[model samples]
Target: MGKAAKKGIFLTTSRFSHEAEDYVKGLDAKIILIDGERLAELMVEYNVGVDPVATYEIKKIDSDYFL
Candidate 1:
């Protein structure tokens, strides 16, 4: 995949160095850099490698319904 690939995703548990970040800016394709913190956030957000422990919903008295 040469010119056909216009976008890419790079995931790392650590981080991207300043030089590595700067290099992608000059490239023809778009590159997304995901660091450790963000990777964890995305994993939780998308339910990847995770399990739902508990969920709760709050309810209030409906005066209109009572009336």
Candidate 2:
């Protein structure tokens, strides 16, 4: 647990009990909890499983355009 103070802790689960949350919060370590839904979101956000099929770009003006 003391090591958490240095490296922190991350817990990913489908659900968390109030008691568990309270216990971790009471610890001096920095604890992060990510539920199943959030874990999935993070995976998608980071492109964990999906493949990059295509790319697109939008035209925008640069400072030179103004100049």
Candidate 3:
């Protein structure tokens, strides 16, 4: 046998990418870009049951604004 395909939380808006197709097809997470706080909420809403990997790339708000 061969190695199984790695599974991950695929996020995408475009229906073209394989990730997007998987997400839209309910095979993966449909990641819609949003604020950290908002993203957390959505994760909960979707019952992901895990902490999102926070990155500056997604939350571009200035540190000052976070306060």
Candidate 4:
């Protein structure tokens, strides 16, 4: 783990639980735990191993628009 950390290999797993998260938080190495949902979201966000077929524009509500 120390060697991997020194080499800048960021470890990530989707099987992290609350206890595991707490344990990893105490480690000196860089580790990221992406749960199932977040992993899916990231895959979609980065287009990893998947192709995006459509795009959408999202708009936020502006208070000034009503004023």
Q: Rate the local accuracy (lDDT) of all candidates.
A: 0.92, 0.74, 0.52, 0.71
Q: TM-score, each model?
A: 0.69, 0.58, 0.24, 0.55
lDDT of 3 by residue, 12-32 (tens): 332245554555467343334
lDDT of 4 by residue, 1-67 (tens): 7356632323354466688789778887766667777777788889887897898999999999899
Better of 3 and 4 by lDDT: 4
Kindly list the per-residue Cα lDDT of model 2 for residues 1-67, writing each as its tens digit: 6333544546565778888889877876667877778888887789987787898998877988787
Provide the RMSD of all predictions against the true structure, rounded to 1 decimal: 2.9, 4.3, 14.3, 4.7
N/CA/C clash count, model 3: 0
lDDT (Cα, 0-100) at 9 in candidate 1: 93
What's the C-alpha lDDT at position 34 in model 4? 71
Name the runs in model 3 displaced over 4 angstroms. 1-33, 51-67
Over 4 Å off in model 4, which ranges? 2-15, 55-67
As for candidate 4, its clashing pairs are none
Which predicted model would earn the best lDDT? 1
The digit string of per-residue lDDT tens for model 1 on 17-67 reads 999899988888989999999999999999999999999999999999978
Ranking by TM-score: 1, 2, 4, 3
Provide the global lDDT of candidate 1 against the true structure. 0.92
Tell how far residue 13 is off in model 3, in angstroms: 18
